[model samples]
Target chain A: MKILDIYARLKRDMNYIEKELEKSIYSDYTIMRETSAHLLKAGGKRIRPVFVLLAGQFGNYQLDQIKHVAVPMELIHMASLVHDDVIDDADTRRGQLTVKSKWDNRIAMYTGDYIFAKALGVVTQLPNPWIHQIMSKAIMEMSIGEMEQIRFFFHTGQTIRNYLLRIKRKTALLIAISCQLGAIAANAPKSVSQKLFLFGYNVGMAFQIRDDVLDLCGTEQQIGKPPGSDIKQGNITLPMLLALQEESLREPLLQEIARIQAVDGQTDVSAFIRMIRGSNGIVKAEAMAARYIEKAIVALKDLPDLQAKKDLIRIAHFVGNRSY
Target chain B: MKILDIYARLKRDMNYIEKELEKSIYSDYTIMRETSAHLLKAGGKRIRPVFVLLAGQFGNYQLDQIKHVAVPMELIHMASLVHDDVIDDADTRRGQLTVKSKWDNRIAMYTGDYIFAKALGVVTQLPNPWIHQIMSKAIMEMSIGEMEQIRFFFHTGQTIRNYLLRIKRKTALLIAISCQLGAIAANAPKSVSQKLFLFGYNVGMAFQIRDDVLDLCGTEQQIGKPPGSDIKQGNITLPMLLALQEESLREPLLQEIARIQAVDGQTDVSAFIRMIRGSNGIVKAEAMAARYIEKAIVALKDLPDLQAKKDLIRIAHFVGNRSY
Candidate 1:
């Protein structure tokens, strides 16, 4: 099933979350208000909140009860995006000017911090200490993951182990928590919450692998920027790691990579993308991602067969297949 | 009593906090660990923790119970300072190379974020939902204050009211929370905590006013950095605002301010400093600071006649009179 079809199942709750997400980011500060509105306008798939609501459905499924958790989870993601743009030094995200590009780095940093504080402020509205603990740990891991990315930037010695650990911290953990927090907040059974966490974790892993793969294969129109923008930013992704392991593709790719690393100007990254795509790296990465998707599907089998379960299964499939 | 003498009263608790503060910043990531260590070695006065401890003393005064809350308060301060250095584009702080100078802005930003996350992670050990709420609001206000500072930078149209509001949010709010959180964490009565918050709020106002004053009158040795460092970074402080109001000093100072705003390089700020000091601006600012100290003393009157109250009074006096 398509992602939209999956989203269609929870349209009411999703729309409410979308509204709450917009309202939550409104600040009295003019720049903050404008920047946050700019981000909200440049919308995402609202996948995290969708996962949150879907997971909550397994329990009491009260929109009012789960929204405080869901909205802030997405806001946390939004805040990270603002900071990430500054780190990537990117000019556009989803065909819109990033906060850092439109303003300055200082403003971007403040905006990110402001949004993060807003997330914390909103989440604290709920009286659950465990939710705070979980969210705090996820945020901490994400920051550390960002730092690790910075440390490993343009470094050619990155192992697949390093890439996996970084992706888990930077990307997967937040998604997993979104599911776990939703379930726990709605008073889902511990067994159900644990399974949702596992399912979300596996889906998160696959989701990131698919994202990395698309960075190599997708077009600028499809991905909202150049296909190899990650490569341009010197982010060593899964396909790149796999490509480097191949003897035939390795040296020529390394030469191009070295040239790109050495210069300040935009080196043509399309050539590097082509070289990686030509290898078995793409196939191997896809197979790995598919395995993760399989694990996610397997984790869902033990849950009570609710309509939300079928939607979640479809969502997991869609994460593996999404182009953008 | 002098500030050091007040500090001497809590030397044992202060020492323990100092060590915990050090231990808390340590991370598995090498860059995070080293950068955090660099910040720790910069050696703040550790005044936030002292206030926290002193306030906690009014309650049950268990060193073990309050240490977690106290340590994170200082960590939040340290994290803001790191980010503030980037905002200020400052190379040196307290005669040492700032994190941005030692590494780069991206590293500095990440380090600040890492420290903030660590603060949250550390504080999550406490079960109090109210502490989380208080700390979250303090952090949110601090970010808004930073954005306001950014918004008002180099704009000479800023009023004393704006300056007061900014300083209260950016500086005083966290200090107030440090005291309030300490009392609350130790299970102090609501009345005692409210009074302590008021006391901290006034003292913090006085503390920041004194800091702004010292930025003008203190020697380089006393202030660590040069006087007018704030002006150099386009920060319009209380003394500068007062100096700008003087008819005799206005035109020349405006001309110099215009020149500084126009050029990117170092403009000689000594002339503006001299002009402000030569006027009654310093005197007026000091009087204002003194008024805040008086207010802080008044807030303490309702509290019990305890050693902590006396120490807090002395601390307020020291803030009003401090050279740096």
Candidate 2:
């Protein structure tokens, strides 16, 4: 089934989460309200919230109980996006002006901080110290991951292991906790929550790998931003890393990267994009993504035969195959 | 009862907190560790930790228990300072280069975020959900106050009430919670915690008012940064706002402010500083600070006569009178 079908199934609960997200970001200040609402309007797939809701289904599912987890999951994701746009010096995200671009970097920074603090505010209402602990640790790891990305920019010497670890912290850990926290909030069995965490973690890894692959391969319409944004920002993604390892492509690829770096990525990167697209790197990265999807599916094997389980398996496949 | 005397009394417990503060910011990432360590080394008065420790004395005071609240209070303050330096475009803070100046803005931003997350991580170790709720809400208010400061920058049309509300969120709420959470963590009586919160809030208001006054009146050697930094950065502090209300200084001060704004505050602000100092603004602001201190002392009237109460009262007086 398509992602839309899954959303359709959880439509009512998703609406509640959407409303909570709006409520959570509301501010008395006009500029803050406007900036935060602008980000909410330029929305994403809300994948984290989806994972949260689905994982909640594994326990005593209650929309009231689950939303506290779901809303913060999305809010944390939104907060990171605001900060990420600032760090990347990105003008637009998802085809709209970023918080930094529309307002200023300082405003964007505070907006992100506001949203993040608001997220903690929502989660703390749950009275579960474990959720607070897990969420805070995840946030810390994500910040470290962000710093690592900056440190590794244009440094093509990084290994695949380095990339995996960074992405795990950056993307997978939050998703993993979304599932775990959702389960924990819903009073799921510990063993079930562990399985869900593993499932979500693998799915998140594949999702990011697919995203990196799409940055080079997808059109602006497909990805919601310019193609090769990763290369433009000197973010050496999985495909590019794999491409650099190819004997035939290594020297020219390095030179192309050097050329991009020389201009501070101001010049056209279509040539570099074309070169990578023609190489075996895309296939290798796709294979890696597929492997992650398989692992995700394997993780869900011991889970109860619920509709949520079936939906998760399909979502994993879709994540691996999705172009956007 | 000097601030140093209070520190001397709490010296041993304070040292444990200092060590914990160091331990909390530790990261496996080299740059993260270095940047965080740099901020820690450029220490402030550690006033928040002092408040936490002093407030704990009214309870079942334990170094180990109170350290959790104390460390996070200081970390949150440090995180806000790092971000504040970015907003202020400040090269130095407290006679040392700021995080943004030493590294880049992006790194500084991440370092602030990382430190803020670590603060939450430390705080959540306490299973008291109320502590989390209060801390999270205070952080939210702090961010809002920060945004309001940005919104009101160079805005000469603002009122005294506007300034007071902004400072309340920016300074007082965190300090209030620092005391409240400390009392809570140590299982202080609710009445005692409430009293401490009031004491902290009023003192914090006085503290910020005094700080703003010092920004204009004190020397670079005394304040550890250049005098008139507030006007240079378009932060219309109490003295400037009070001076703006003066009939004689109004138009000329507006002109000078316009001149500073035109140059984006790059020009020397000594003339503006001299104008404010020569006006009644400084004395009026000092009087307002003294009033807040009186209220702070009054807040402790019903509290049990303990050394902590006397210390709190002394700290409030010092905050009002402090030159730096």
Candidate 3:
């Protein structure tokens, strides 16, 4: 199944989730409402919510029942993006101006806080402390992931383990929770929910690796920002990490990084991008992402085969193959 | 019934709370643990926790039962302060370097987020969904309050009602919840809990009003920073609001504000301070704070009179009279 086919199957539910996301972000304050709407309108793939709805389909598929989990999951993602933009000091995301660029960092911070509060406010209505426990842990991990990212910025000593762990907390955990919670909310069997979690976790890991690769390889139009922004911002992702392993490239890369960090202006990133692209780093990262996709598919094999399960397989492959 | 006497009575419980607070902030990550410990060491009066304990006394007070609520309340307060410093671009708070100043805004934002997550993580361990409900609502109100404050900055058209509402969310709502949640956690009577909430609400209002007044009249030694920092940062407090009512002072104050807003330097605030101090604004603001304290005392009149109740009355009066 193609990504389009899976999306087609989930279109009605996705529309409902979209509306619920919009409804959940309503604030009495105008700037908050506008800031939140601005980010929401920028549009994401809704991958987390999509995973949530798909996982819920394994048992007791009810859009209304799972939306409380789904909408907030997406809203949490949106809230993080707003704050992430503030941290990145990026002017645009997905080709639109960020909240920080449009207004200011203070406005962006408050908007993020407000959206997070609304997410919490809506989630607590579930009447289940277990769900709260899961979400609180996800949020905690996500915050830790952000801290790790900030501390690791421009640091040369980072390893593959560091990269995996950071992305695990920043991306994989939330996606895993989105799937697991949806299954749990639908009263799916415990084993099934656990399997869904692993499946989503592996898929999420692959998803982020792919995103990091695209950050280097994809163009401005494709990735929605300038190519090589991660390196420009001193974010050492998988592609850069792989490139650093080459003995010939290491010294030059280190020199380039030092020069880039020393200056405030736009230092040319094209030379580094050209060097990395010429190396086998992209191939190695892609292979690793493919391995994660395989693991994700393997995890879902134990669950009873259904259309949703098929779509989960398709999503894993799509994540592995997605260009941007 | 002095502040020191109240501290004497609550000292044992406060120590336990202090330990629990330290334990709750422990993280596997070094920066998180260090950043959080830095803020925790730069202690406030632990007023919110004290309120929680004092209000818990009205019911079947168990230190273990209420300590969970009390510690997280303080942690949430700490998290907000960290983020607030980033927003204010403040170099120091409470006589110590702020988290932002110590590290950077990125670290400060992450530390605040990590602390907030820890607070939420601790709170979710409580099984009662109602407690989650109350805490969630308080968090929502606090977030909205922060947004209102951001929007209201440098806003000349704000009213007394706007000022009151802003402080209600920023300060009083959390205090009120600290009291109300304490009563609820101890399984207090509903009417008693309601009364405690009102008492806390009024006390918090008066507390913030007095704090705003002190911001104008206090010396650098008293406020732990220079006087008029609020107006310096575009925060128009109660005294300034009242001073704006005087027809003659209004134009000069507006001109000073515009000038302060324009150039970024150490503008002499002494002239405006002298003018406001010479006016009736301080006296009027004090009267308003006194009324709130009176209402706070009145809220508890029908409850079973006990030492805790009397201590609460003393706290309200202390808040009304506190110079810092």
Please report the candidate that would top lDDT against the real structure.
Answer: 2
Model 1, B1-324: lDDT tens digits are 477888787988888988899888877778888888999899989888988898998788888779878988998899899988888888889999999999988888878877777787677677777887788878888988998887888889999999999999999999898889889888899888988898899889988888888888999889888888877878888888898898988999888888877874277888778888898888999999999899988987888899998998988888888986
What's candidate 3's DockQ score? Answer: 0.65
Q: For model 1, what TM-score is found for chain B?
A: 0.97
Tens-digit lDDT track of model 3 for A31-66:
878887888889989998998899998889888878
Structural similarity of chain A in candidate 1, as TM-score:
0.97
| Cα shift from native, residue B278, model 1 (Å) | 1.4
lDDT of 2 by residue, A1-324 (tens): 488999999898888889889999998888889998999999888999999999999999988888888999999899999999988888998889999999998899999998888888788788777888889889989988998888889999999999999999999999999989989999999999999999999999998999999999999999888898898888899999999999999999999999999988898999999999999999999999999999999999989999999999989989989987
Q: For this target, which candidate reaches the highest DockQ against the unseen true structure?
A: 2
Measured by TM-score, how close is model 2 to the native structure?
0.98
lDDT of 3 at A28: 73
The total of clashing pairs for model 2 equals 0
Against the hidden reference, what TM-scores do the models get? 0.96, 0.98, 0.97
lDDT of 2 by residue, B1-324 (tens): 488898899899888898999899988889999998898899888999999999998899988888889999999999999999888888999899998999888889888898888888888778787888899889888988998898898999999999999999999999999999889999998999998899899999999999999998888898999898888888999998999999999999999999999999999998999999999999999999999999999988998899988888878878887976
Q: Highest TM-score: which candidate?
A: 2
Model 2 residue runs over 4 Å out of place are: none
**Chain A fold similarity by TM-score, each prediction:** 0.97, 0.99, 0.97
